[model samples]
Target: MRFLVQRVSDSSVEINGEVVGQIGKGFMVLIGVCDSDTKEIADKMVRKMLGLRIFEDEQGKTNLSLDTVGGQLLLISQFTLYANCKKGNRPSFIEAGEPGMAEEMYEYIIARCKEQVEVVERGQFGADMKVSLTNDGPFTIILDSEQL
Candidate 1:
């Protein structure tokens, strides 16, 4: 499992011109699942994401967690995060998880996030999603299960 997390002032996801998910003053997260991923890894990601102290506090320090700032969450599934481009011009998704397991883990992540996040919005899994966000501080973090 892997997560690409970006702090955002606002974010939205559109599929076929219809808005599917949106958030404000929160993290815009893209989730990717690998073939070997399990819910345990997903759980670890959820804990790290919400607990990350990246939001600003009154002292203008990046010391507040999402919960402390009452931030929302905009989560999206992105199999392309696992793209392998070492061999050729075209990227290979061979490291991406199978659709069924990936979607399941994706859904599981969403459910867990909903519990900790004040507002949790999610893009449709497997959809051709168009995501837009105003990155806060242009901050981003990438988390991989292998690192845990």
Candidate 2:
């Protein structure tokens, strides 16, 4: 599993021209899954993500976690995070988890996040979503299961 986390002042997702999910002062996380992923890995990733101290404190130090700042969440599934373009112009998604398993993992992640976050929003698992965000500090982080 991989999570591309972007700290945002606000974010929103749209599907079929209808807003599906939106949030403020939180992380816009694009979650990716692979065949080897499990709930345990997802759990670890969630912990690490929520524990990140990228938010600035009163001293202008990046030392505040999501909980401390009372941040929301906008989680979106993105299989293309596993795109492999080493061969040619076309990218291969063979490393991405199968749709059925990936969707299950996505839902599990969302549920876990909702338990801790006051406001948690998510895009449809298999939908073509249009995501918009104002990246706070232009801060971004990538969390990978293998790295954790």
Candidate 3:
């Protein structure tokens, strides 16, 4: 599992110009899963996303967790995150997990996140979605289960 987390002041996802998911003052997390990803890995990623201290504190330090500031989450499934471009121009998605199983694990992450996160919003599992966000601090974090 991979989590591309962006701190956003506000964010929204649209399909056909119609808003589907959105959030205010929180993170816009794009998730990617591989065939080897298990529920345990998903659970670990959820723990990190919720507990990792990326938000700013009163002392102007990046030391606050999402829950500390009452932030929300806009989770989106992005298989393309695993696209491999080493071969040619066209990216290969051979590393991305199968749709059926990946969607189940993605939903599992969402459910786990909602357990501690007060406001959890999400994008459609497999959709051509357009996402927009005002990045807070332009701060981004890429978390991979293999590294953590």
Which candidate comes out best when scored by lDDT?
2
- Model 2 stretches with alpha carbons more than 4 Å out: none
Clash pairs for candidate 1: none
| Candidate 2 lDDT by residue in tens digits, 1-112 | 9999999999999999999999999999999999999999999999999999999999999999999999999999999999999998999999999999999999999999
Q: What is the C-alpha lDDT of each candidate?
A: 0.94, 0.98, 0.94
Worst 10 residues of 2 by lDDT: 120-129
Q: Mark the regions of model 1 whose C-alpha exceeds 4 Å error after superposition.
A: none
Which prediction has the highest TM-score against the true structure? 2
Candidate 1 on 1-148: residue-level lDDT in tens? 8899999999999999999899999999999999899888889889998999999889999999999989999999999999999997999999999999999999999999987777999999999999999999999999888986
TM-score (C-alpha) between model 3 and the true structure: 0.97
Residue-pair clashes per prediction, in order, are: 0, 0, 0
Question: What is the alpha-carbon lDDT of model 1 when measured against the actual structure?
Answer: 0.94
Clashes of 3: 0
Descending-lDDT candidate ranking:
2, 3, 1
Candidate 3 residue pairs that clash: none
Can you give the TM-score per candidate against the true fold? 0.98, 0.99, 0.97
Q: Give me the displacement of residue 118 in model 3, in angstroms.
A: 1.1
